[model samples]
Each structure stands twice: as structure tokens, then as C-alpha cells.
Target: MKQRGIWPDEFTFAPLLKACANLEDLEMGQGVHKHVLALGFGRFGSIRIGIVELYSGCGRMMEAKKVFDEMPHRDVILWNLMVKGYSQSGNVDMGLGLFRQMGERTVVSWNLMISLLAQNGREKEALALFHEMRNGEFEPDEATVVTVLPVCAQLGELDLGRWIHSYAKSKGLYPNLVSVGNALVDFFGKSGDLETAITIFNDMPRKNVVSWNAAISNCAFNGKGELGVQLFDEMLDEGVRPNDSTYVGAFACCAHAGLVQRGGDLFDSMIANHDIEPTIEHYGCMVDLLGRGGCLKEAHKLVETMTMEPNAAIWGALVSACRTHGEMELAEYALKELIKLESWNSGNYVLLSNIYADRGKWEDVEKVRVLMSGNSIKKAPGQSTIV
Candidate 1:
């Protein structure tokens, strides 16, 4: 078109800009921005929205802000995009600020803000916002219900989750939407109410991979490893394709139950039949399983054979195994690898020192203490927050 002495319109630029954003080609995005400016298209709302999205996608928040500030009129969609960009980039406060600045908000705006806060571990603030939203006469939608339910589950706020469930039921929103039902399943699963999770799952008119993964993984996480294993079998029997997460959940179950041979078999089957390449988490689970069974050498070899470099968790598992089995030399080796990887967690130092102390190696214990003190490393105190 340029060769023909013709210019592309906003419709032409929007898709091109979106392509640039998807590719993260900052230079191309800038070129598009320049073209938009040269064509005097900045005043067009649709073009401006695309520009904002392009800049935000390229991580040029300042540029996006410039576009936002110059917009003579804005809509909820524009506000939603800006808030989403901030939240996605870990600037939750900025996202909330943008939301508060808006004179009006849609359900999308409210859900985005609430979900962002809840997903990012600001459960207390999320709950407060939910309550405030209700007080202001904003009825919670399916998205809002789904978003905050997991927060309640994670914080073990079963009562809050139950209240949300009740509200969702009263609003005639339960068991219909897969998303809402899935969230409820996850919430109950995380709260150690496997029976309730199962009931919800069974009652769901539809089930997705997320619903199954959540229920199974929660069982493993909550120390019902045997039951989790059983569920894994049932999931397979039902022909629900297990993904990498499912394998991890099953491996975790085997690890917790000290089912070494079974764990190894399942690990092999994951590669053979499931065709899901084992990730670092899966490798870590195997190490934990073998280590707990006094198969330190096997665990060490497994780490060595891993396709990717073993992370701190894998080494930590070996170190823990060594400590459990009184394999001081192996523990020392694992500790050295951990330290080499720059894993500065004070607990690692403490664990190694305790191992030495257990073996009556006073000199080694003293050395570890000296190193920890020299580095000013202190163990973090365990604290629990109700809200």
C-alpha cells in the first residue's frame, strides 16, 4: 500500500499492532505507534485502545500511560485493559489504584480486581473487597464467586467458602457453570474436605482437567496420599487424560506413602504411556520417594540422570535423605551442590549442621555455624496468619 502511495487505516493497524504485541517485538510496536501518530489516528478510541494494549504487552507501561492520559473519553474496556496490564506485571497496587480512579466499573472490572488480589496471595484484601462490593449493592457474578472461592480454600477459611457457596446457591449459580463448580471442588479439596470435593465433582454437570487435578493433588498435599493414588487410578479408568500435573500428583502420593517400586514404575509409565516428559517437580518427587526409602544412591543417580539441572529442591531432598539415613558423606556432597547453586536458605545450613551434630562431628558443626554467622543468615520464624 505504501508502494502504491496509499496508507493503511486503523483497521489495518490494529491487527498489525496486535501481532507485534504477541511477538513482543518492541521495535515493530514502536514503528506502528509512529505510523498511528503520523496518520493522526491517536484521537480514535479504537486505535488508542489498541495502542495501549500494544504498549502494555511490550512492557512499556509508561507509553501505555501516555496513551491512556491523552484519551478524551474512556470506557470500561479501556480501564479493564490497563488494570489487567498492571496486575499481570505484578503491580497490584497500581491496578487497584486504576480501578478506584474509574468513575464506573463493570462486572469485568470488579472481577478482574478481586481475582487479581486473590490470585496474588492478598486473600484478606480480596475478601474485604468482596464484602465491600456486596455492601455497595454489587451482586457477585460467577466469575467473582470462582475467583474468591480459592482464596478461602487456601486460607482454610472454610466458613467463608461455605458462605460463598450458600450465596452462590441462593443466587441459582451453583452446579451449572463448570468454572464455578470447579472452583468449589478446588476450594473444598484444599480445605481437606475430600468427601465434599468428591461430592461437588460428582454433581458437576461437566468436569474439566483442572477439576480432576485439583481434587487429586489436594488429597496428596493434605496427607491422604493413599486416597490420592486411588483417585489417580480412577481418573485413568475414566479416560481423563492425565497431564504433567496429574503425574506430579500421583508421584507425590507415592512419595508420601514410601511406595518406592510403585513410584518408579509410575514414573516410567508416565514417560512410556502418558507421553508427558517429567518436569523438575516430578524428578523432585522421585528423589523424595527414593530418599525416604533409604535408597540414597538411587536418588542421587536419578538426580544425575535428570534432563535438566537438578534444582535446590532435588538436592535438598537428597540432603534430607542423607540426614535420615546417617549418610554423612553423601549429605555433605549434596550440601556442597546446594550451596554451589546459591541456595542461601538458612534452613539448609541448619539441616546440614544438625546432620554433623548427629554424627558427633563437632568441627564440621562449628564450621557450618561459623559460615552461617559470617553470612548473617538467620532462619525465618514460622508464622501463621488467619486472614
Candidate 2:
């Protein structure tokens, strides 16, 4: 069009910069910036948003802010973009400041800030903000419902979550949006309401991979291993391909219920049938299953031969199994591996000392005590939060 002597307007560069931003191509965005300035389009609000989008999308927050500060008339969309830009840069404080400064707000704006808070480990603040959003003029939308349900689940805010579930149903959001149904399933399941979780799962208008994952994992969590495994089988029969997380939950159910042979079949078929490569998480679950079933040697061998290095959780599982099965020597070895990975964890030393004590080796127990003293480690007392 330019070669044909057709001039580019605000429409041309706004999306071009958006594309650059989406691709995170800083150099291409800068070139577009130069074109915008040469064409005097930077003065236009829409074009300025594109400029901000390009800069912030590429993680250049300062440049985006400069463009943002110069805008004479900022709409809620621009404010939302600024919040998004700051959140993308992991600058939650700046995003919150911009959010608070907005003269007017939209659900998109609230959603942006709430998501930034939740993703940054500020669940309490995110929940508060959601309440504020509710108390105010703006009604939570589908995005708000999806984003906050997990935070509610994390915080054990059962009342708030139930309210949101009702709100979604009232707004005709649940089951209509597969994501809303999936979120409700996850929230209810984690909240220890397996009955409601399963109800939602069955009532979902559609079920995706995530829907199945939430159900199977929740069943595993609630110690309903039989039902969990049945769901896994049903999922396969329904021709929905299980991903890495699906196998993790299924293997965990096997471990919990002592279905070692079933776990092994799933592990083998994960590669053979589904073509999904086993990650370390899958291997961890299988090792956990073998260990729980008293197959110490097989579990140990699998840990040593893992494609990726076994992490602390794997060693912890092995040591826990050893104690349960009275395999003191293997427990000692697994504890040592666990210690190498987490030397500061006093529990590993305590476990090692206990293993020695079980074996009538007082001297080894004293040495483990000395190791703990030398490292300035203290056993963290077990505490439970009622909420």
C-alpha cells in the first residue's frame, strides 16, 4: 500500500505494533515506533496505546510509562494496558498504583490487578480486591470468576468460593463456559467437597483435558483411588489424550491404593500409546508407587536410572517408604541423598539418626546429631493452620 502511494493511518501501525508486542520483538517495535513518530501518529491515543503495548510487551516498562505519562486523555483500556504492562514486568506495586489511580474502572481492569496480585503470591490482597470489586459497582465477569476461584481454593475461603459458584450459576456462566465449570470442579475438590466437585464435573457442558485432570487429581487427593483410576480409564475410553499431569495423578492414586501393576502399565503405555514422554514428575509417582508397595530395590533402581536427576521429593518418598517397610539400610542411603540435596533440612538428619537408632547404632545417631549441630539446623515444629 505504501509503495502504491497509499498512506498508512492509525489503524495500520496500531495492530503492527500489537503484533510486534505479541511476538516480543523489541527491534521490530522500535522500527514501528520510528515510523509512528515520522508519521506524527504518536499524538493519537490509539497509536500511543500501540506504542505502550509495544514497549511494555517487550518488558521495556520505562519507555511504556513515558508514553503513558504523555497521553492527554487515557481511557480505561489504556489504564488496563498499563497495569498489564507492569504486571508483565513483575512490578505489582506499580500496577497497583496505576490501578488505584484510575478515575474509573472496568471488569477488565479489576481482573488485571487481581490476577497480578494472585500470581505474585498476594492471595489475601487479591481476595480483598475481589471483595472490593463486588462491593462496588462492577460485577465480576467470567475471567474474574476463573482467576479468583483458585485463589479462593488456596486460601480456604469456602464461603467466598461458594458465593462465586452461585454467582456464576446466576449469571449463566457455569457449564456455559467450560473454564468456569473446570474452575468450580478444582475449587470444590480442593476445598474437600468431593461430592460437589463430582457433581460439577458430571454437569459440565463440555470436558477438556483440564477438566479430566482436575477430577482425577481431586479423586486422588480425597483418597478415592478406585474412583480416580476408574476416571482415568474412562478418560482414555472417551479418547481424550492424557497429558503429563493426568499420569501423575493416576500414578499417585496407584501408590495410595497399592495398585503397583496398574501404575506400571500406565507408565509403559504413556510412552507406547499416548506418545507423551515421561517427565521426572511421572517417574516420581511411579517410584512412589513401587516404594509404597515394598518394592524397595525396584524403586531405588528407578531413582538411580531416572532421565533427570531425582529431586528432594523423590528421595523423601524413598526414605519414607524405607521407614514404613523397615528397610533401615536403604533408608540411610536415601536419607543421605536427600541430605545432599537439602542439607539444611533438620528432618533429614533426624530421620537418618532414627534409622541408626532403629539399627542399634548409637554412635551413628550421635554423629548425625553432631552433623545437625554443626550446620545450625533446627527441626521445624509441626504446626497446622485451622483455616
Model number with the top lDDT: 2
Worst lDDT 10-window in candidate 2: 378-387
For model 1, state the Cα shift of residue 132 in Å: 1.5
The list of candidate 1 runs beyond 4 A from truth reads: 1-7, 170-172, 343-347, 357-387
Query: 140-249 in candidate 2: lDDT tens per residue?
Result: 98999999999999999999999999999999998799999999999999999999999999999789999999999999898888789999999999999999999999
lDDT of each: 0.84, 0.90
Per-residue lDDT for 228 in model 1? 80
Ten-residue segment with the worst summed lDDT in candidate 1? 378-387
Q: In model 2, which runs have C-alpha deviations exceeding 4 angstroms?
A: 1-10, 360-387
What is candidate 1's CA lDDT for residue 140? 89
Candidate 1 whole-model C-alpha lDDT, 0 to 1: 0.84
lDDT by residue for model 1 (1-387), tens: 789988688688878777887898989889988998898777777788888888887667888888898888888888888998888788999999999999988777888888889878898998888888888888889999988988887778889899988887788788878888888888888887878888888888777778778877878777888888888888889898989988888888887877789899999999999888989999999999999999999999999999999998889889888888988899988987897676467767776676677778888888887887788876557621111
